[model samples]
Target: MRVSFLLFAGLLLAAVVSGCGGGSAASSEAASSGNTASGFTSSAAIAVTDPVTVGTLKGMSDALVVGDHIVVRSRSDAFVTLNGQPVYPGTRLSVLDKQGKLVSTTDYGFTLAAGYTGDWVMMLSPDGFIMVQSTSGTRLQHFDAQARLVGGVTDLYPTVAATSTTEYAAAENGGAVDGNGFWLATTFSLLPVTDKTQYVLKLCKFDFSGRQLTPPFMISTSALHPRVAAAGGAVLAGWLEGGGGMLAMWSKGAGAPTIRSINTGGSQPYPLVLTTDGKMGVLWNGKATMTSTGGVMGVMIDNYGTPLLATGRTDLTQETLSAHWDGNVRATVIDAHAYKGGIAIAGSAVGALKAGEPITDVLVLADYTLGTDPLSSSAQTILRFTLPGRAALGPTPVLRQMLFDDHAVLLIGDDNRLQAVYTTRNR
Candidate 1:
């Protein structure tokens, strides 16, 4: 059975703030105003809108907020015969306007049969082009802003090793190449080092049309999960290896990446993000120790790869913030994005009442400024949404965290419908 439709829903909450800086008076005032219907308050200058429906889907999917559109890739559970073949579920691309209204939908002409699993990465170029690269036979697929599958590139690399890990991609200007200013920082595992124990990690550049603009630059033979980001013409990638975080800065015409390794400790680094001020920010989970609480920790570096914080890294989760939770909490960094002169993070926090008690989880939103003293401002829980408990027998719903139009939005899917809550900086 084939099902396609668009629907609208009511707004649950709308809280507006008036200033910047975490744990500031502005945040306190907004929280005290009791302007929320969902029990979530604003910490920074942000305004949250009502929930809207994007589309319906069954199985796995992905969603991203592009300039003025929300691009979604959805697949169903039912099968349909196409060209004398039963396709379990081919991937479909859907585009929705800012108002959560469906704009367009198209099939990628690619499908993954049952029990097939591989890594997939979707990136939006600065020029509104959508690029989806996967190790699941879909090497690289490109789509225009209207959600049309234009073209794709042939697979040139070997299959990823089963034991090797992968990471997200970042896109930036190509610096006057082929009338396509967009390029992506991507990684590939050419061969296994020791029978799937490790792999030779190589970073390369690919234009929007899937053209390999530069040769694959080898980074490490043991690095896993390369996270890439670009801003102000600076391309950066990082991964985990040697019990530390490996960071590298690459130029469009450089021989190799100018690399550096930082002590990420027990926590793994999240995806690399491009700050609004043309700098790169790396956020990671703070490993819980006997001396400190486990929360979110981050570092910001300039284009030259210099740490802007005096401590090299700052722990954003603490009790001093105006919008803070009680007791020690373990944070799961679900998503992070650069928006409105800073970076916003959305995730879940699991906290217990005491050392030996039950734990509850709450949706967390944190906001930080991209200023000279970025670390001086703490990461307060700007907004808190309660995550509804789920039943035991069912697939986990898809949760997407997005930062667009000065708002932080979260999309949750269940029972074939996708509902979204949009939050933005009102000022």
Candidate 2:
């Protein structure tokens, strides 16, 4: 794991040095809006609010909501306390609507934060720990959303595996439900110390009513950094499993997961993403021997983790990458040489049936490829019209949070600002 982290850091440094400089604020804002002839549309106006400037250094950890508001977690150095005593560095969470107006703000008063945006409810916790706060701390603490903190310390750290340390909270239904709409899915690790290292992957479901729908259920493999996507009543989770050697998916209402190992010849699973409609994709360096052999691979999956379509290597070497899905179609953006040179690929599901055989979906890759003439790409020129305010993008950008709602596609970049691309025609 340590080696993997070091390798990732080195790759990131190399990308930054070779890629173009960070994009300017103006260029990041000038991207186009509305549907294109190619079937791509502008972000839904409902999800976009006027941009709010929180601080000079906008950490990637800040939270933003597309539809009603955008929340910027103010940088710690610029902390201003309501009463007295310094608020923890990452303790401030701001709120704003689509019009960029300030809706509300809260002082978490602690450090180490985690959060997920839903339709109406935003779940937040500090240091992988969600608990009730006492009134002895400060007056500002009393004003925040106060939900009854349940369970004991043992219930919190149910597992002791090293890989189980970092837990991410995701909304099962875009956090948009009132009665039975959405629930919070908390994915974490339970590591048991022994002669051999092992981990237990667990997912705890909590309804909007703040009650535990079910206790944490363990998945068989050691999957890390799992992501969940929900559509209708179905929930899909994709994660790096089996010591980061395999990509796995499990559906809440769809039964057991069907795991697939990427034949990368000893390369880590890398990052995996699934579209709102349940399409699955993964990106990784092809082999440990070569630097230029890195590429992205994608597959379309049914509710039962069955692959409906598959896309072979889309070669990318020493480049920063990101991907998102527009329904069953997958779209990827690659910035090589520091955001100077870039390529965009859009893939659709194509399939045919064989005599006496069931139909299998095939992924047909189409080049919407955009880059500088020949070579020497310019960051400003590549994504200027797509992601405004995002500059010197990284490979992780390809897997940044892309939320698909009924009306539009929400492109949340590493910068924490969001771009909404609508799908339906305006009435």
Candidate 3:
């Protein structure tokens, strides 16, 4: 395992925009009431923490809060040929305590081949196990509550052997459930049938034991950018189709998945979030034709694949700021969390840029109640933070709401350094 570390001289502080108001820290009344009195109110103080060092990387590939410690998975910067196979970089897992102190670090010797198409998995199971599946899908490593690797299982099916130039975001092709196992929605090319090849999309479920729990469910012959989410014993698989997107909802004993097309403008749906109340929230970019500026649109759907809102859609960017994407400067949704009776959306935006100014990025956190029209005009609080440091945005920032329920953190990497901030529902 090759490890590299960079030491910083000064501390960077984030600039917070205070106009938007947040609700009380995990207050049930604030959560139950679907309203934000101020154009921006203070529910969470949005505390800024000093950057947590994790070494050189594009950005945090994935991050999840387990207990009070944060387990972060990052791909290293070094690239080399191992065993005659050109590879990208080795995978490293780091655990950090509440005070931004590093607890432990583990380096998986395996490196993903260049142009690997499979999406990796790092999820926390309900029983307090941190499951890390390699991009190859050949090995499943388990970590105890203390972030220690106890043992691992191997040899189910390897998905990373095939190389494709097509790029993918983290968890773009797969997702996991808390208590249940994870699901993968992918396409496989079948052998030549009548001298012609055919591609088929499939959704498969596998438990932590590295065992396939159910037979693969057929989705469609062709689909792009597949995403999955499961909750309340129901699973949702979605993919880009035509100019919009298609969704399929299925349960354990259900006959088949119910399919529907969603109108999300031109951008693909992202970050599928299943709430505790058997509701699913789908978010997408509402971009106009030939314009970099776009609004974030969201919709709430019940487990039965039925719309829950009046119009079945909420314009999140309208209540906040529009996400603009230029040649390099870009902003889009990253992650979200469903709270007791509300939900919070996290995004990244480009800060003010000049010829000689250090490039800064902004973190957008928008909170909304989960009642009728959660993101209604009067029900959302959007907060923006100008992050510290001069770094070019490549790897998207990683945002994870802590398990404590009252706090959330964002990991930003630039110039081979990692920085973080914590947001809370307090003044």
lDDT of each: 0.50, 0.30, 0.53
Off by over 4 Å in 2: 1-52, 55-57, 77-89, 99-104, 111-196, 243-255, 262-297, 310-427
lDDT of 2 by residue, 96-186 (tens): 4433334565554333222211112233333111321111110011112222223332122222333553533221211212124233323
List the candidates' TM-scores in order: 0.68, 0.45, 0.71
Error of 3 at 324 (Å): 12
Task: Put down candidate 1 lDDT per residue, 215-292, tens digits, no spaces.
Answer: 867667666555667655556777777667777775445556678775676455553544532467667666443234
* Best-performing candidate as measured by lDDT: 3
- Model 2 TM-score (2 dp): 0.45
**Where does the lowest 10-residue lDDT sum fall in candidate 1?**
1-10
Between candidates 1 and 3, the lDDT winner: 3
Q: Report clash pairs, candidate 1.
A: 11-50, 46-425, 47-424, 407-423, 407-424
Off by over 4 Å in 3: 1-45, 50-58, 81-87, 111-119, 126-139, 146-148, 158-172, 191-199, 251-254, 288-293, 309-333, 351-360, 374-378, 389-403
